[model samples]
Target: MLDSLRKAAGTWVAKLLLLLLVGSFAVWGISGQLVTGMGGNSVIVAGGTEVSATDYRLAYDRQLSVMSQQFGTRITRDQATALGIDNQVLAQLVAGAVLDEQARKLGLGVSRDRVAALTVEDPAFQGPDGRFDRNQFDYVLRQVGMRPEDYLTNREQVAVRQQIVEAVSDGLTAPDAFFRALALYEGEDRTVDFVVLPSSLVEPIEDPSADVLAKWFEDRKANYGAPEYRKISYVKLEPEDIADESAITDDQVAKDYEASKARYTTAETRRIEQLVFASEEAAQAAADSLKAGSTFDQVVAAEGKSMGDVQMGALTKDKVPDPAVAEAAFKLQANEVSPIIKGSFGPMLVRVTEITPETVKSLDDVKTEIRKALALAEANRILLDVHDSYEDARAGGDSLQDAATKLNLKVTTIDAIDRTAQRPDGTIVDDIPESAALLAAAFESEANVENDPINIGSNGFVFFEVEGITPARERMLDEVREKVVADWKVAEVAARLGAKATELEKRLKDGATLDTIAAELKLEKQTKRGLKRQADDADFGRTGVAAAFGVPEKGVGLTPAPTDGGQILFQVSEVFEPAGADASTLPEQTRTSLSQGLADDLLDQLVARLQAEYDVEVDQGAIQRALSF
Candidate 1:
């Protein structure tokens, strides 16, 4: 539970796991066993275990908190719903409940003493003394709103689930053939001889008749069509626009500096290392020896373990896992070892390795930062009033220009902007406020609809209305005569190119060499060597590289040129197949890759078996109700 809590508080990904554990406790209760649903409180039922609504809510909140921190934005309930965060959280909790049910059925569980020991080892509940402090522990529980019993019980479940995972992944190894095949496949290379035939290589055709151009345009009218474009006007409200730096006086900065003194003051922290024992008597004996002038190395050696095995990294008192060890550790001077202290794991000995003294920055040093923060806070408050005023005026059916005039903001308009923010002439539309959101709202709304103010990144909102719209229509032949002529010529060239390549392929099959053909056509034949399937060869392009590998040795092929607007006629000159090497002679990277693949396979199989064994039931209605907020 300690590890999970620590991870949950620190990372976005780990928060999901943390919430699942919290939810499992509420649904499963504190019996150290799986239980059926108690009335409608259960939101999920996997096998015999049930997940309660209280647990679901706790998990969702934690998950949302981590997401908000990770994204650096306060995600609203509507946004969370749009992102399907609630469904994702529910799925995670259900999966966790399934795993818990399986672990219990197998009689795999962690002992209370072991859970306690691990909990105490966590660094979060430690006091400044580098040991677990009961008061600090209680305070942390209160902060997270967790009962001590619930936390401990959740930790035990985590341990049991971990045991099952470890057992499934143990001793897994990939076959030698699998590794050899993958390595060789990745290393294989090919060479090709080819000639590029761009549309320019073909003789230019004469201009077609008006009738021919019209027919050509009619054949491919979609290419010469225009997209529906919208004309819109908007008022963008941003916090910075409303901020008054002059209003942030020296007095305000000083008060802010005083109020947030803790931010400027660095706390004294101690670095401590600890060794946990399985029994209190054994731990006491080791501590007595250490206190009597024996070295930690000597004590570790006596316990038949290496000193390196017990090195918990340096942490502040509150960061330490066990309260008792933290208290004893902080009381010791640098390089001093503590006697046996009752640890959650059992008996433990702690040593203070180093201490960092506290320091505080004076007001002058942080005044600039404080002033900026205070001004920003004031700006945020001002933006709220600005947003409300803008909404009220718009709701009263005032024009965008009128609303902007009343609110003292500028209204910007675009004559025409498509969904992709491009004009009919292909030039991108610019100088629009909150362009992406503005475009989205414009395109999504009908003409004259006033859109709700959209929340912009951290600082602003954009309210927009579609002024007018132009429906898409195909271009007339005369309107796009130049483009139609170009398309006709391109079609003629492509047809000739394809036919010529086919004839060349036939000639190659009839025993003609590429050198002779290139000489006859007065074209240069380029040669590419040692190209891998994954390589990006400018001469061959991606398609040419794939074609080179796809062709048989000395076989000819044709592929379209990627960007130069032509086709490539190529012949494979050589191929390098991967050598089959034994697994032992392979590189460390190869071995690691094979090992990971084998482990993934084992885990997949484990999950499949668990799914087959468990009867999973989800309350879709309950999930919907919970996420409706």
Candidate 2:
């Protein structure tokens, strides 16, 4: 919570997520397993775990959450599909289970005491008073769909796996050689010899005759056809707009002020030193010696653990390894011995030598806070009433005018916008126009004239209607002739470039020199800087770098590479082979990365993994059902 107020000023996506958290949207659709449904289902399996609807739905929600973070509140379904969340989520669950099996085989273990200690000690799972709050823990558990017992079991597994991860990943460091290679790949710069073979290089003859043009249009009829859209008017019922607000009496204000006085208090915090022993026996033995009226320093020294050494002193209850132990100890007198309590550090007795209690403020001290809280409550009551009025207005099939009149809300009219104008914020909707359906419906059909209400977005259910049509009439041929000619020329140039590449390749095979071809094409020899196999950020970006790599290894001559600027002729003046992979440079947790890379780059690897784990049988009945509705 170390966030600044200014940070949220432009965080629209964060605001959207907050709305989703409070609104509890109920979009209807049951997912998972082969059930009797119109929607067909597919299963991704690994080990013995089944990927069901429950898992898929969770994965979808998680994916949407991430997309919203990256692209703001407005995300398209296509974007989610491209990210491969559906497949990745299943793969992750499978890999997690596989790792669990491997961990079990290795006999890696975490103790029950450690789990208990960690849970109670986490500030998130604690109450305002800094004590372990079971209600908070249970609330989070219910939110994520796990019971107390089930959560504890999973937590245990997580702890054990974490230990295995720590042991394996500890000091496997990055080598200098690896860093050098990475820098080379990531930092390489390239200058290239190229020429723009724009289509303009070729002369345009004439536009296709009417007969040819008509045939081309008919062949691609699908592109010209428009999608179906709905004309809808909705009466929205928002809770914040309809509540009743009544004035509060002076007596009530005083009462609230008195009751909330403690809100102004700040709890005292403790500074402590913690030492986790290697074994419970050693911890218990140390505690026993300290309890025998021994000087805390003396006990440490006797046990070969000193103040200057490890395993030692000075703790406030809140800083104790276990919250339960802390609470019990903080309640003790100074220098008091706590019962042998099991904590994250194992069995121990704490001696709290300090005491500090929260200081509460007087009623007058918190009067301002009371007033602010009352104002918000009163405002909400007023909003609730407004919401009810809106709901009533929407009851009948009412026009926007009728709904606005009934709700006492001012109806604002907007006109002359495209499918892109749904959002109030002027942001580009990359790859998709979410407002396409509504905008098209408003303008395309003749039936939807000027009576549409403002349409709300995903969270807002406001309706928008078509006020007028601004049809995109085709431009006169003479007006766009220059552009058409330019496009035709560019295409022609690209073809010429392709022909030139073919001729160059043939001549290079026949032992042509770099200078010979250069002089023949009236091109100069161009030199480029650094290049890499994996990260091709050379001359331009990927396309240019790819062309560089595409150069023939043994045979010499210029290779034609594709580029946005123009076609580039890359000559393979030198060749560099990668050194063998360094063991020290490899990531200790390479299994998951390697597996994912294999799936992405090698079709055979992915299919092999899929076959090895799952006996996949597609049921046509289920498949058809899933696709329907």
lDDT tens digits, residue span 1-629, model 2: 00221233144333322222211111111222323332435333333434444434544454455455555575665665576544444444443343355466567777899879866875556777989899987875555444677556556655664554444443444455655565444344333434333323233435656565445455544444332323333234333233222445567768886676556766653433333456778777767776676766565566565455432345534455578666766566655656566676566555555556667777666665566667667655565455445556555666666766776554544433445553223344342223565555556546444333333443233444444454444444444445445554455566666776667667756777656776766666655544565454544466556665565544333333444534454555556534443443445465344433333333223333443444333233443332232
RMSD of each: 20.7, 21.9
The C-alpha TM-scores of every prediction are 0.56, 0.39
Among these predictions, the greatest TM-score belongs to 1
TM-score, model 1 to reference:
0.56
Q: Write the residue-wise lDDT of candidate 1 on 177-241 in tens digits.
A: 87777667677888788887766657677888878887878889999888898888877788766
Relative to the true structure, candidate 2 has a C-alpha RMSD (angstroms) of 21.9
- What is the RMSD of candidate 1? 20.7
Local distance difference test, each candidate: 0.75, 0.49
